[model samples]
Every structure is written in C-alpha cells, then in structure tokens.
Target: MANHVYTAAALAAAFFLAPANAQASPQAALPSAEVTTAVDDVVARYELPGIAVGVVVDGKVRHWEVRGETAAGSGERVGRDTLFKVASNTKAMTAALLARQVDAGLLAWDDPVVKHLPGFRMYEDWVTREMQVRDLLIHNSGMGPGAGDLMLWPEPNHFTRDDVIAGLEYLKPRWSFRSRYAYDNTLYIVAGEVAAAVGGAPYDVLLRREVFEPLGMDGCRIGEWRISEAGSVASPHVKRQGQWIARQDGEVVADMPMAAAGGVRCSLDSMLRWTQTWLAEEGDTPHSGWLSKKQREAVWTPHMPMPLTSRMREWNKSHFYAYGYGWRLSDVDGTAKVAHTGTLSGMYSAVTLLPELGTGFVILINGEAGEARTVLEQVLTKHFTAPGQNRTVAYYAEDLARERAAPESSAARQSSGAPVADARASAPRSIASSSELAPWLGEYRDPWFGDVSICPSDSGARFESANSPRLSGPVFNAAGRFLVDFEALESDADAWLDFANDSPDGKKQLTMAKVDPDADFSYDYEDLHFRRTGECASQ
Candidate 1:
C-alpha cells in the first residue's frame, strides 16, 4: 500500500550511482522499442488501476517497471516494490518451498501425506490408499472448488492437521483417483502443513529460511505483510458507482495459518527475483544458489495431464494448460510457458516464465476493479505477438463485463426479460425486496453441494452454505431462478438460482440457471441451465 524508506530522492541518487539495472532480457535480444509498445497497448486497452511489471532474460532483470496511479483517483504513482496479493500465485511459492525441502532431503516428493501428519486421510477411500506428496501438488486431491474455504473466510476458525484429514471424509472426488486435473487450494494448504511438519517449524518461517532469505528477497515475507513505511500500501482499487475507491481486504484473512496457498504478499521486484531463481540453470544463482538441476527438473515436470486439455487449449490457444508442480504449463512464443496467477480481494498478479529461453516476466496489478486475466493476457499478447502483427485478440465480452461489475454486485443481479420457464438465468439488475425474493428463498440441495439455503432477510438476499461463510447478493436477474452476484471473488465465482413461476394460464413450473448463463463458466454459456425440483415450501 505504500513505499519503503528509500525515498524518491534516494531512488534518484541510487539510479545515478548504480547505473540503472533496467535492461531488456539479456539472451533474447528482444527489441526494447517493441517491449515498450506491448506494455503501452495493454495499459491503455484495459484501463488498469496501476501495474508493476518485470522481465528477466539471459540472467538479468532489465524490465521490472511500473505504470498508472496507485489508486485510480489518486495521483500517486505505483512504485517498484508495492506489496501485491498475488492471489493463487501463492500456490507456486508454496510448491517451490516443497521443492526446496525435497531437494535438501528434508522431505521426500513421493512420501505419503500422512507420513508428516498422521492425521492425514482422503475423501475417496481409494485416494487415501494411493495418495502421495506429488498428488497434493497436483490438483488431483478430489476436493471440490472450495472444500475448505469455509474454515478460512468471514471468520477465521481453528482447524488442525486432523481437521484437514477429516475433510477427506467429506470430500466428493470428482475424478477417478488421478484421472483428471482440477485446481483446488485445499491441497496446497495441506502442502503447507506438511512443509511445517516436516521442517519442524512454521511453514512461513521455513519458507523464509529455505527460499526468501538466501535469495536476497529481504523485503518479501510469507504470510506476514511487511508494511512499506505506511500501512496504506498501494491497495488495489475497484470502480464503485463509476468512481475509483481503494479496497480493503477482509480483516480476518491475514491471521490464516496457510500462508503458502494464498496468504503471501510481496513486491514486484521480489517476485522477479523469485522467478529468476527458478530460471537459473540448476538454481546456481549469480550469487548463492538455492535450487538444483534435479530439483528444477522435478518442479517443471507435468506430472499429470489436465482434464479436458483440448478445451483449455481452445480457450488459450497458447499452452496445454496443465499443472506442472506450482505452475500452469503452456506454450508461448515457441517456448513452454510456466506461469501462475493470483487474486485476493482487490489485488491481482501473474508471473510467466520461459525457462528454456531464460526469459520470464511477472505482472502485478493493484485493485480488483479490473480483470487480471485480461490485464495479463494483454501483457502477454503485447510481448509474445509478432512485431507490427495485426493479431486481433478475441476476448469474450461477457467475461469483461463481469470483471468490471464484480465490486458492485448490485447491478449484475437483475433479470433482462420476462421470466421464462427453463430459460437462461437472468441476474437481478438491481436489489430485490424481500417480497420479490421471498418466493425464491429456500433450501437447495444437490448430491454435490449437499444443502445450501437462500434466505430473504430485513437486509437483503443472503446465501448460507452448509457451513461456509454467508455470501450476499442483490437481485440482478429474474429470468429463471433468481441470481445474486457476490461482490468479492475472483474467477467469476457466482451462484445459480431457481425460481417458481405461475403463468397466466395457471400452469406452475420451477426453473433454475446461473444468475446469468452469459457469464457462466459452462463451455457453452447460453445452454447453461439448472432446474428446480421443489419450491419455497422447502425453505
């Protein structure tokens, strides 16, 4: 949210004395002029709040830089080391820690998860019998989208190694053992627990000892946010009511024990250094190296093929989009691109690397007011696309709209047309009164979700998960089931809705779909629909 003690004058003095280290990647021989064009095009196209980006090629970081305002409405410019919540990118860091520990003989890559904490078990009886440390790093743990998030959000609750193990019993394994790939943060949290247990220390503390401290990443701290001189460290901003406002993340989020998964924050430069270490040949750094050739090879291994690899390739048209340890593997510019993207409330960031080419870049952005995917895709398209090429990037419009509307969930929860039976969902375009929402408020249960309740209260429409934090939404649509858009989540995580309608002919029917299929993650958006089996009588 703010800068370090090295003031502006100090930066200027250092620039003069230290011959600005800002150089283009050393090995690629990429035209500096072309790099500038890519960055400008991305910044202008997405209207970013502010961004800090760095590129390292040929063993030197020549393009770590910043652009835009700290907050959209404020004149303050983003700096080199502003703390950013690198969302799921935290997975890579946590994975790296595991890799390092494995390399140092502190742990074994194939060790059973229960070996570290005897409390470990699995939801699928088969998984418990066959699970390994590598499986945890892979997204094959079978935990659902947010299996354990309930324990970490709204209010920080206590869960032990046993709690994580017990979650295994409650899990509904989507894939047959390791047959598919699905991203789950719950496994990474378990990884952190294993790291701590194996190292006989806190995971964050072990991470600093193994990775951060030796890498000269003195400024970056895991879990603990080292406030830059001021607490108002360039917070991510979101557009609320057409105005840019600084967004504050949840107060309870910091106290989480699983810093390895999504709790870490660090500056852009620190991030660059971290990735640079991975790109080093066998982790033999220009200074003291921490990783090795075997370790690096292990980290980059695509241990398992992703589920529906064809579909993800169709969407990206770049990489195969599989999990390689802590990174997402894809091909970019004729090189295998290993990358990770992060999101936590208003902050978003991504780091992409082409290790074979020794060229990698990290883009860190502040403010959830915009989409990190677009912001990052813009950054990549600018750099990887041919110079003066007329490659028109085809981005889905509905995705962009959801990114712009996320902070203000009120506007998106509205219906666009008259209710239709079994038609696509229409989110409430505005808040719905209890009377308008009452007919739809009730308990919904699926074999997968168990039981979730929609209740109308004096305040508004509230969604209560079986034991998860309450997510509130304003009525944005009413086409089928009523949909409410949650104000704070990345990856467009929205709820589906179901409603009962009695037509002019006195015919009764129940229907449900995503609040808006147009924005649903379903491969075919409009075809996305969910039917209701019961009515308000079930509430």
Candidate 2:
C-alpha cells in the first residue's frame, strides 16, 4: 500500500537523519537500538510535520534530536535553532522571570496583586485585598469559563495588561476564592507586572536580561506577531472530524508591556537551556546563584489543589496532583515533578522532570499532538525501570492497528476519528439503566452557576466545558443528587485527594466557576463544594 511505503520511508529517514549527523550521540544512549526504533515509530505514526525533543540529565543538555520537517510537506528541516511557538509552556518561563524578582527580595509569593499593578482588583471585594502572587499562578480565580478568554485568544483585543486588570469589575465570581484550582492566563500577566514593577524594567525586558540571556536562549523572544507574520510560525492544530487540521492564522496578542504568562518563542534547543536551568535548580546539584534552593523548593511545593483531581491523573499515571507556586507538582516513581503545560490555538507544549531520576524532557509540536504528557511518561518508564529498556513515541501504531481492528460503534468512532462520526445524527441513547442511573443522575442546579445535568454520555457520565479538551477531561459520577463531584479514578486525579464523593441528599451540584488555570485570582479546585439543585442539571 502507498501508506505502508510512506511509513517505512518516514521511519528510515527519522532514524537515519540525525544519528547520521549526531552519529551515535543518541545511539550511545541506553537501549539505543530500541530508542531508535521508538523514535522512528512515532515519526511514522503521527505524520508530524516535525518534532524537536530534548532530554536533560544532571545540569547538562544530554540528548537533542528532531524528525520530519518543521512544516511537514515543506523541505524545511528542523535544526537545532528551529523556532516553534511553545504555547503555554511559556508560562514556566514567565514563572521563572517572577522568581528572579524573589531572588532580589523584590516580591514574595504571598504578595498581593494590587502591590505592583495598582489598578488590579478582583470581582470579589474580599479577594481583591487578600489575593497573593501565588494565588494567580495557582488558579484560584473564580471567573466564569471563557470569561478571561475575552482578554486574549481571538487576538488579545486592544486591551493593555492594565485594561485586563481594569475589566475585573465586570467579571463575576464562579466560586469563593481559594475554593478550587482554576487555571487562568491573566494572572501570569499580573505576575509579570509584579516582577516588572519591582525590578524597574518591563516584564519582557526583565525576562530576557535575567532568564533568557543567562540560559543562552538568544533566539528566544516574546510574541507581537502580525497576521502577515503567520507564515513565520507553525500552524496551531486541533483534532476535528477525524483528522488534524491547521487552525487558521489569527492576529497575535498585541505587543503589550506585560510579560507574564504565555509570551516568548524559541527553538527546542533554546528551550532545553531553560529546561536544564530548571532541572539543575530542581536537582541536588543545582545551578547556584540563579535561584536559591529554598526559592526553587517553594516553586515545587503544594500551594493549591484544584477540585478536579480526577482529570490530572490521566496526565501522568504515576503521580498525584498538587500545585507548587506556578508549577504543577506531581510525583513519578517517587520523584518530585515541577511541571507545566501550554496550549495555544496552533501549538501544544509539555515539560516534565523526575528530580530523583536526574532527567527532564520537553516535547513540542506545531500541530495537534494528542497527549504528549502520557507519551513522555511511557518513554521514561521504559528508559529507567526496564533493564536496557527502550521506548519511543509511535506515530503509526494505532492508525495501522485501527485500520485492521474490529468494528466499533458510532460514538467510539468519534473518539478514534472514524467515518461513522462524520455522519452526525441523533445523540446516542444512554446505556445505564435509567432507574438505577436516575437516583445518581438528576436535574441539579448551582445557585452561583448554570443548569447542569448528570446524564449518561458515550464514555459514561462526564462534565462538558465548551469544546476544549483541556477544559473537559475529568468526568463526574452520577450522584443522583444536586451535587457534581469529580471521580478519584486514575483517569481523573486532582492535585490532592481522589475527591472521594459523599452526598447526604445526593442532589447538590457544583458548576465550573473558573476554568482558567492561569488567572491571578484563581482558586484551589478541591476546596469547592456546592449545595444547590436549581442552577445545575444532574443527568
């Protein structure tokens, strides 16, 4: 078949290209043969335009490699300096810039937002005075879903960072402050502002001088891209219908002085420099004078836990969830993990490290790379635990298998990208017995939120958040009550606690007040619990 030949050629090129140049640089690694096999497999499977992967050990750049083309069909080979929009992984860089301020005694993690951005205030009167720097990075803001998306996304509007801060008056509270871990983006801007206000420099300038410069990320710079500049960037990708499609290029969030979350672009090699710095600071033999051990520890400590612990688990099989300052704290094979992930319209990014394992990794894709977090863990688990273990991201395995796999239902097809999903029709009926499922499923309502229903879905019972994959991963069980609870199931683990559900009336429903994990006023997720039947629907 044409597809089969394409797979073989891709595998051959992916394995032969870099190793041909870096010859044995990768081959010398453990299970070198197997790793080559895995890498080739992934390149062939996904048909990725290109991928820049780096592995760090101790405080040095250990392995760096790339495959395919940066623009796929184009002959543009991904070299050491190939620039990729890192999406949200840029948040960690933003956090590190903030940490530079802490090193100078400029700001404390507990400092209030209004300290630097004088115009800043939360919708909640009580919170405005009490909010802390860590609160914003910790996702405690309760603003409604897509509430702050207005601030950015379809081009950050003409609003300055100050404009976003000023608009908080109109934003409503989704839950009480500190009730749950809600992700938000606006908070990063504030954190950047706090750093800039104290450091006596703009946030972008401070980041370059303090972090980017020292790390030798000279190629790294902040984004102020124009519509015409879209050609310079890799296309952001999302899965639709049954294939990965390139999202149309849109205007870049204007060049704002605020340099806190989700700004900055560079190559995987440059990113590795930052990764090495964090990995060193996170490890025993740290890069001294950049961040004190205590300061770095603070970044890795549990500052907040979102209510949806269930979904965090699917992110990593070995670890439980807990947040550390701006970083999400997870444990793998008994190692502490200070990690963050970013999703921009056209690109996706992931960074993970096993401090105990003396390893850190970063994977970036211009298109939709489904679940790189799990793939990273899978590779690491084999790399360390298995004697002479070797594993790589396989791109074609599933497609090939599914091509010959057994017939699946229409819903299953949708999840896996089958033609059956293309012929959309009536919503599939629920399989769970209505009587037994009814008590657990009901018309539940939250006084502070909208009508939420707990009904059987294709994959069982779940909560939907717009159509964002990151927005909706944790599914809830049918409590048959007004309450909405997150499942402790590994498929959905929160920062802490499995969120063991218990309902006296089994009719209390809780709705998402804030889904932005990158906000300044975000709340801890586990702390949220609701008791209302009129606002949310329970299916």
Candidate 3:
C-alpha cells in the first residue's frame, strides 16, 4: 500500500512538472496533450527520477519539456539548464570535430589511422595498417562488443588516452577486419586522440572551438572537472530497494580519458542548440561552417551494416540497420532516421534525427530506464506516422511486466543485485587445499586492462583488476574451475579463470571468461588473456 501511494505521488509530481517553463521560444510544434500523456505514462511506469525531451523541426526547437524532479528525494525541480551526462551521444560530437579537420584539408576520411597516429595498432598487423580514420568511427573494427571497455567501465583508473592506444594490440579480434559490425568504444577513444593530434588541441578543446562555441552551447562541457563546475547538473539515479536513489556525484571516466567514447555533459538548453545545428546542417543551413555538406554526408552515410534481431526487425520495421560515422542509420516507416543512444552509469539518453522530415528529438533521463526508447519512439511516431501508430509504449510496458514477473533463481537474483557468494563468502572448501590453489596465484596482465592479480587479501584469495579497482572479489573454485565473484559489482558478472600449459616449458597462462550467463556484456571478461607474471604470497 505504501508503494502504491509512492507511485501515485511520483506520477502526480511528474504531471505537475510536465509542461515546464523551458519551451523553445517561438515553439514550432508543441507536444500535444496526447504526447504529454504518453511521456508521463512512460515516466511513471519506469519510476524515473526525471527526464527532459526536446523536439526540433526545421532547425527550430518546437517543444522542450522537463518532467519529474532533479532527483527522487530532492525537491529541486529540473530546469532548462539541468546538466545530464549525455554518454555516447558525445560520439557524434567527436565525429563532428574530426570532420572540421577534414573540412580544413588537414585530414582525409579514408586516411589510414596509422598515418595520423603512427603508434596506433590493432591485434592484427594487417588490420592496424589498413584501418582508416573512418574505421575508427564505425563499429566495424572487428573487435567484439565492449572489448577493452573494462579499462574504463565500472571504475576509474590512471589510464590516459595514450594507454588506450597502446593497449589496442592486445585486444583479440572477434571478427575479421571490416567483416562485420560489432559495437566498441575503445576505437572511438582513438578517434578522439586522432582529432586532437590533427587539430593541434585536446579533444575537448577541439570540440569547443569547432562545435560548441560556434553553436553557442556554453553550458555543454566534456571533462568531469568542468561538469562539477557546471551551474546546474542533474543527479544520476538508480533504483535500489524499490526506490529511486540519486547518485549526486560524477563518474571519474566521464572526465577526460573516456570522454571521447561516452563522456559528455550537457543540458536541454545546450542540447537544443546541438540538435538544431545538426538539423540545420542536414537542410544545408550552415551555422559555423565547421563541416561541408560532402563531409556531413560522409558522416551520415552508412559505413557498415549492423545485423538486426528479430525483435528489432519488428520494432522499427527497419529493412537494414547501418552505422554512420558516429550516428546509427536506419529507415523507419520509409523515412531515414539517424539516431544514437547513450548510457552512463545511471543516466540514459537518446538522440533521434529525421532529416527527411526536418525533425529531431533528444530525450535525456537521470535514470537508466529502458523505457527512454519507448518515450522517444512515441514522440517520433506521433509526428511522422498515423495517429494510432504509437504502440511502442504498450509493447515495452508489457515487456517490462514480463521481465518483472519472471521466476527468480540464484543467477537471476545475483543479476538483479541479490547477494552472491561473494568474496565475503566462506573460505574455500576444496580438498585440493590452499597449496593446490597457490599455483594459480600470480599477477596476470592484459594489454588493455593492465593488470589483474590473484593474490591474498583479507577476504582470502581474490582477483583484482588494476584499472578497475572495484573488480576485486573472491577467487574460489567452482565446478572444477577457478571463479571470481565481483562483490563490488551489483551484477552477477563473475569471471572464470582457466589455466593452461601449452608452452614448451609447461608454463601456465590464464585466460578469463565471464562464465555467468547473466553477466553484463560490458564486463567482456572473455577478452583478457593473462599470462602469469609472478607468483603471489599464498593466503
């Protein structure tokens, strides 16, 4: 009953805050009452802390609205300038900065990345030599999904952009070069470095001069230090104990190093400018002349095709899905829709551009609700298609209901943040004893992730990653193989360390895999090939 009341109150608050004061001056097409109802319904269903959506048509922001509070408990209302981490949406901006260099005849789209940054390398020498600047922006780098992400995801480290470049040779390729599309973030970081090298400034500085300043998006910023200094920033929120809790802090990776891939902080006000710039440029209306139409077309042109799941095929009715430089390209209802979704730790954001309609919208949320897609879809369908065509909200609501009602198991509970037999769990019970396990105890290293040591800790034998300190957890035997439970992580993404003696001298090498079926894909434990560097003192 208390939960019911909380839900009602939350919905009421959202309703009250639905039509915020932040409207696009000279609003072109305000969200109708129907759109408001749909947006409010989705927000209530997800119990999001807050969300801001901006709709722009023909280079004019038709509508901009903020719903919900700055956070779950904070009574502070989210205003037009409330800054939110715009994660991978930052990628498009990076591509734009690089495009400016191309516009100046400083860099070419097909120029080999190695030409710009000689130290750049991939797992394969041929791939490293053949990789073009365009390849860095596309997801067809032949690496697996989220490969090398462990270097930055879940925690911050002392890694620099140079470290990211140096670590590339170690990431094993899951596909042949340009053979298929597999989304990755590491290469984008490289792209940022390339832009910085060619532009004679840091990535963020380059963006400011090329993109932000020209558009007058003063509130938009790149590094964490700048984000902290921003006037008003939305607190990132996560659901805990059936309540939305705000994390009123910024992620370290969102600062400078990883900013190239997913770190961008901006508000609805600045994002309006950014989106409007893109819409204007799409219509041959130049703002700062940073990019030529040919360059813009190159960025929007589909570079590589992405496979569609059966559900995705049905959802957008997309015949094919491909990647533009930094944008995702697809056709919806026979109209080309260029889009991208951004997900930080707690913030979820999406930007959609319909060049054909001269329409685009950006939805920024403080919570990681999957329903952000539904909200944006509803808005898009409402404008582009027939009146009764917006059934995405219902479909997503049903999907969430089904997910919530599924029976719970150990794996499911662990995946959903229930306690696991973590590092704090009881010590090892194997008959093989500590001496038998000591052989596996050593400092293991991966090129991208740096180091992960299997060493003695207060909790017993543990596995810890150098780049991601929170990855430290209990290392115990399970099903005859050594396993690790990342107690600090809410998810059940445990790693399995398999030792082999394929060397001529019978030297052992450790290869890790996220054996848990429920592990987060970003964990990418399978990407690490750790050779035992030195023995550790046994626990």
Highest lDDT against the true fold, candidate: 3
Task: State how far residue 402 of model 3 sits from its true place (Å).
Answer: 6.2
Alpha-carbon runs more than 4 Å astray in model 1:
1-27, 143-165, 225-232, 249-253, 283-288, 307-321, 369-424, 427-456, 459-470, 473-514, 517-539
RMSD (CA, Å), candidate 2 to true, equals 14.2
Error in Å for residue 442 of model 1: 9.2
State the TM-score for model 3: 0.84
Best by TM-score: 3
- The lDDT values for all models are 0.59, 0.55, 0.73
Per-residue CA lDDT of model 3 for 1-539, tens digit only, reads 53543343344333322322222223224446655676777777677789888777767776776888877877888878998889999999999888888989889989999998999989899999999999999888889888888776775566777887898898888779887778899999999989888888888788888888888988787754643467777887777788887776653325557888988888998888887777664334557365676777777766676665555556556565667788887666655677898887788888887655567788889986756656556455545533445554666667657766877777876685443434422345332235556777778776577777877765467787777788877777754667777776654566677888684556578887765544556788878777767777553
Identify the superior model by lDDT, candidate 1 or candidate 3.
Answer: 3
- What are the runs in model 2 whose C-alpha is more than 4 Å off? 1-31, 144-146, 223-259, 281-287, 306-319, 385-539
The number of clashing residue pairs in each candidate reads 35, 74, 1
**lDDT by residue (tens digit), candidate 2, 180-243:** 5567777777777777788897777788888877767866767455645433445555545545
Can you tell me which runs of candidate 3 are displaced by over 4 Å?
1-31, 224-228, 250-254, 281-288, 374-379, 390-392, 399-436, 476-481, 501-505, 537-539
lDDT for each residue of candidate 1 in 303-357, tens digit (9 for 90 to 100): 6555434424443454344567787765544445677777655677888776555
The TM-score obtained by model 2 is 0.63
